[model samples]
Every structure is written in structure tokens, then in C-alpha cells.
Target: MTTMNKLNQVILSATLALAASGASAQMRIEISGVGSNQIPVAVAGFADENIAPQQISAIIKADLERSGAFKLIDAGVITSMSNIDYGTWKAKGADALVVGTVAKSAAGDYEVRYKLFDTVKQSELSQLNVSRAPQFTRLTAHNIADDVYLKLTGIRGAFSTRIAYVKEYDKRHYELLVADADGDGEQMALRSNEPIISPSWSPDGTKVAYVSFEQKKPVVYVQNLITRARTVIANEKGSNSSPVWAQTGNKLAVSLSKDGHTQIYTVNADGGNLKRVSNSAGIDSEANFAPDGSIYFMSDRSGGPQIYRMNGDGGEAKRVTFTGNYNISPRVSADGKTLAYISRRDGNYQLYVMDLASGQEQRLSDSTDDQYPSFAPNGKYIMYATQAGGRKSLAVVSVDGRVKQRLTTQAGNIKEPTWGPFMQ
Candidate 1:
């Protein structure tokens, strides 16, 4: 199938362990090629009698700053709109200003009201009222950041989304982790002594499908995030790997070798309704669903491992890659207009993106061993795993190959990152 380190040879059994909440080591982001046209904005601390204004404003500022899209102005002197000096902010090169207030409600909850103002036009662009439980303080801040981002950029923000990945703790210990988009709020969703790989998030972001070798063979399992319970979906006669969720979240496209040759199959999320999807004699695996519901996968049907596209029911299979001899791990964007994949060029595996409309391909990563490209829900960035300094870590890059940042962990190697869908 789509070439992966065979872990079935190793045999070890271990139970899952719960790690502390949040990232063990917050990911340090490095920015590059941040465009000069960055929108300068000022975020004022929310006025509240009890809540710490800096605590809420920091999250919003960090979210905007890390995106490489906006530059934050010094708003330490401005706390609420009642004292906002729009002329001074505009003179300080701010295009927009965000001011807000947080107040405790009679029901013991918190209500946050924020306004986005266009400094140039001297008019308010948008206002938001968010009511949230006290325990969801961080989440409430992220929600405000999302709203501010959408109001200014006109595109949905993925700050509220989570990411799934595999964390290695020595040779025999591994854990599947789910973390915030900024690499914080990490939680151990699944743990095993055997190897774990290919953690895929369901479209609804409530479950994760992954391949585990705990039973001495590569088996696919879908685990519920809330209950921490799992259902063995593809533990048939042979190896099962590369489980990818369909857009509907009710089905998954996986690669199985039960019939002696690796091929793609679709199975219900609840472990029933098994149906073969690809009939190619050659190996077909790593199937990902496009926005339009078509399946794009990797196969060697043309004598080399290349990307292929086919219908959801496994008919009319067609080749999608021509320039490279080795191109695998095809991930279509949320919009289905762009395809991101890994290509082996000059003996180096790197990330590349293809514009399906113009039949154009552009290399997006410079790392030699970059793999497992997952597109952000907004389709503006792609996150993938790469080896650096002899350690595997996750990195994110803009679709255009600029604005790159790396996320590393202090625990161990990080791999197989899958960006979760937009929050419901």
C-alpha cells in the first residue's frame, strides 16, 4: 500500500495512559516570509470588574499574531471603547481596532461583548456578544478570536479547531494526542505499546480513526473522544491501515490486505457494512475524500506509487499525477480545488501542491522527509510531519509555501498530524 513502516512485525501490548491536559511543551512558532502588507490592528483589553483583561486579550493577540496576517499595535493604554482614540490609533498605523468588555451574569456565567472598528472609515465593522460558562474561559477567548478573524478577513478562522497526532515515548510507548490548533490543550486520546500511525479525525471532530499494532498486526480502530471507548473497525484476516473518514463521517475509506493484495475499502464507522471500493490489482491505499465526495488515493497501478482519483463507489479510476515517479499521501483541500501531497524528487521526499484547475504543481516544503500533509479547515495552511535535528515534529506552512512554523514536543517524536475540522 502507500509505503509505511511495517509495524506488524513488532509485538507488544500496553494500555492507554492519561496525560496532563494542555501541551506539555507549548509549540514555539517561527515565522518566515510574513508579507509586508500585514494588517495592523489594535486589541484593547476587555473591561471587567473581576476577569483579568490581559488574560483574555493575550489569547486574541497571540492568535492574530501567529497567523502572520495581522500586526498588533500597543493597546496597553486603551482598555474600553469609551476611551478609544481612533485618530491616535490610525496615526499609529492601525487599520482596525478591537475593544470589548466582560461582565459576570446573574446566572454565574460570563458575557463578553466586543466590537471591531475600521480605523480608516471611523465606523464599527462588527460587534459580538458571547455568553460562556466560566470553565470555558480559554475556549471563549478562542471563539472571540475566531469571530474577529472572520469579521476582518471574510474567511472562517480555524483557531477553534483541534489537531490529532501520534506522540512517541521511547521505542515501545506511543500515545495518540489531540491538541489545540496552536499546539496547546493536549490530551491523550489513545495509548499503546505497539506502534500507532495515521490518526485521522472524523468530519464532525468527535472521533478519531487510527492504525494500531497492539494486537501484533496493523488494525484500524475508531475511538470516541468523549467516552474514550474504541471499536475495532478493520481487524480482518490481514493488515489494515490508512483509515480516512469520508466527508459524511459515517463511513471511512481504508486500505486492507485481507484478499492477499492491498486495496481500498469502505466500511461503516460503527464497524459494519463492509464494501470494497477499489478493484485495482495493484496496491491502492491512503484514500482521502474530497469536498465533492470523490475519493483521491495513492496507488502503484501505473507501475509506480502515484496519486489517483476515483468515484466514491470505486468506479472510473483515473491517474492524477504525471510529473513524478513517486507521489503519495494525496490530501485534497476543503474546497477540492487544491491537492497537497508528498513527492519524491531527487531522492528527497518533500511536500507539493497542485492546482487542479490549471494542472499546475508547486513545491511547498523544503524538508527532505516531509509527509502526511493535512490541509487546514480554511484551506489557507497545510500541516505535516517532518524530521529536523534528528527529531520528528509537526510543521505548518501557508498554501503558497510561505509563512512557515514548526511545532515540537519535549516528550518525544511527534508524527502523523491530522488537522481537525472546523468546530461545529
Candidate 2:
């Protein structure tokens, strides 16, 4: 989540091997596991590489492995592509082949060309094309890999998407940053020596709304992504934070304390016409919208943070979750079939996704700690942050919990990973 977006630029650069040149930049979750079945495949090195100094194969291998797909073959463990080539890969259990070439353009730009070959059929399967952008050519490998992923897997690749997260380098200070989904090219959106928390993305994916303490107290501000321009969206005398964008694309369901208790309120994106949604005395802070025009939230009025559902129009909320001791962060999936949240299981905090209809609960992780799960635009995956082995990291898991992927590097502690709107 921390480097989720910035690393999209240099996912396949050799610099990652050195673990340098990406302090503020992004890289992907480097996982060490082979797929259930290693497909027979070989990736030839790029011939005309650029100044990246490190080769791109390692990064590519990491992405493939993290997906729990494709088995990478070691070069030393194999012979040349031509010498024993005809059926060598297929015999070695390689079902595919990948080859690439890199070069510096006459205009001083970087370019990479890659091809995916189906070894079983002995023919090229697809072509993954990538062109570099300003100061971001290094991310070419991720784009290429993503293209290959979509073509082969029939799912939209997230290689080009961005991730929004909060970084608390100091215990009391925090900064809201956006980076590549793989944790490269991290840049600050807002920084405060005071505590900052909870970032929500606009429907247009062009701006972010987050709670900041830049003025010595907590306040919510809608920040422009391109211009870095920000204006106060909601700032009350009491606790005012935890914003969730509405389906209408203009209204934000936020919790305000200017009244007395932190109840749900609806206000314009520019901060005006505050209408109360919840009038309860207990906490109603974490709330998100569902696709079917209902609001799902957490409330301790039931003695614990039980899940509650209410209509888009303000009314009495109906409690939905009954089997949980603790539940917060109600994330409505794009399809609205499953609800993802953080809950306590076996005395540890873990990510949980529940079947909205059957109320069946499933824990998606077993780690030191996990928090803040945001669903991908397609609803196929959920991205969350985790801490394990005394290290902070970001991870992505498939909806059914079959595939779990760590998507961040060892750069900084990543918190609050909010997925962006569909980019297609």
C-alpha cells in the first residue's frame, strides 16, 4: 500500500536487486514461494538494455510468483534456448516462454519490447507492449508484465494502477502519499506533524479526501491530485474524519462531532449543507456505500462494533452482523455480494470477508497484524496492509482467498490502502 503506485514505474529494474535507488520510489512485494504447479517457462534477457544497471528478470519473476502463477526457471539450471531448444522447455515442464529487448530511443527515451510464447503450442501467444513516460521509463517492465498477465489470465492487470496510503514515519507525525501499486515513485499529498488518518478516493480518481492536523487540530480536506491544491471539506469543533464517497459522486458520507456524538453526516465535496445521517449517541465513524444504495457502517451502540445497514436516506439502522465480537471498516464490494472488514479472531486482528447473504465468515490472513482492506475496482481482489516478522508490508488477496499477494516493499509502514476507480 505504501509503495503500491510509485513502484509501477520500476518493477523490472535491476536497481531493485541492489535495494537502492527506490527510497522514495516504488517496488513490488518480494515474496518467496513457488506456485502450486510450476509451469515450464523461460524468460530470455533483454538484449539492448538501458542504464538501469540491474537486469529486469528478477522483478518480473517476483511479480509472476506473487500472483501464485508461473514458475520461473533458473538460467544456470538450463541449457541455451537454441542448442537444446525444440522440446527442451516443454520437457522441462515449461508451458510458456518470454523474451524481451530493450533500447534507448534516438530521442533519449527508454523502450522495452516483450513477447509471450506458448511453449505447449510452440507459437507466440501474445505481445506485451510498453512505452516509457517522463522520468518513469523504469516502470516499463511492470506495464509489460501486466499486459502479459491480462492477456494470459483474462483479468485486467493492476500494473498501472496507483495506491493511496498513510505513512507515519514518526509515531505522532503522518503523511498521506500516493505511489505505484508496487510502492515506487512515492510522493506526499499532505504532511502533518500531527496525526493524520483515513484517506478516501474520489470517484473520478483525480483527488483524495483525508483527515489532517495541519492547523493544530484534526480536519478533513479534499486535495487535488494533480495540482496538490486543497480546500477544507469538513472541519468541526469535535472529531471530524473517516470520509466515504457516495455513489452520486459528489456527496461524502462523513462522521462529524460538531453536534455531540460522532454520527454520520452528508456534505458536499466542498464542505457545505451538512445533513445528519445517524443521530445515535454511540460512535458511527467508519461508513461506506453499497452499490444498491444502502449505507453499511459500524456502531458500538450494540455494546460492540457490530455491522449496521441503513438506507441512503436517513432512517433507523438495522444491525447486520451478529457472529462477530469486533468488526470495523465496512468495505462494500463493487458487486455488493461480499463485505470486507477487519475483525478479531483467535485474539489477533485479521482481514475478514463475509458472505452478505449467508453470513459466512472467512479469515483471509494469518500474520502478525492486518488492517485497512480496500477492494479492487473489479471486486476480484482486496488490498490490505500487514505487519509480520517485525516488518510492515502490503498484501493483495483474491476474493475467495485462494491467492494472497504481498504488494509493497520494505520502504515504510503502509496504512489505509484505498483502491482507485476503474481506469478503463
The Cα RMSD in angstroms, rounded to one decimal, for candidate 2 relative to the true structure is 5.5
* Runs in model 1 lying further than 4 Å from the true structure: 1-23, 48-54, 104-108
Give the range of the ten consecutive residues with the poorest summed lDDT in model 2.
1-10
Across 222-292, the per-residue lDDT of candidate 2 in tens digits comes to 88775557878888888888888886678888888887778998888888888988868798878899998
Tens digit of lDDT per residue, candidate 1, span 301-410?
Answer: 89999998999988989899999799999999999999999999999999999999997999988889998999999998999999988999999998877678888877
Q: What's the CA error at residue 11 for candidate 1, in Å?
A: 33
Off by over 4 Å in 2: 1-41, 51-57, 74-88, 128-130, 387-395, 400-413
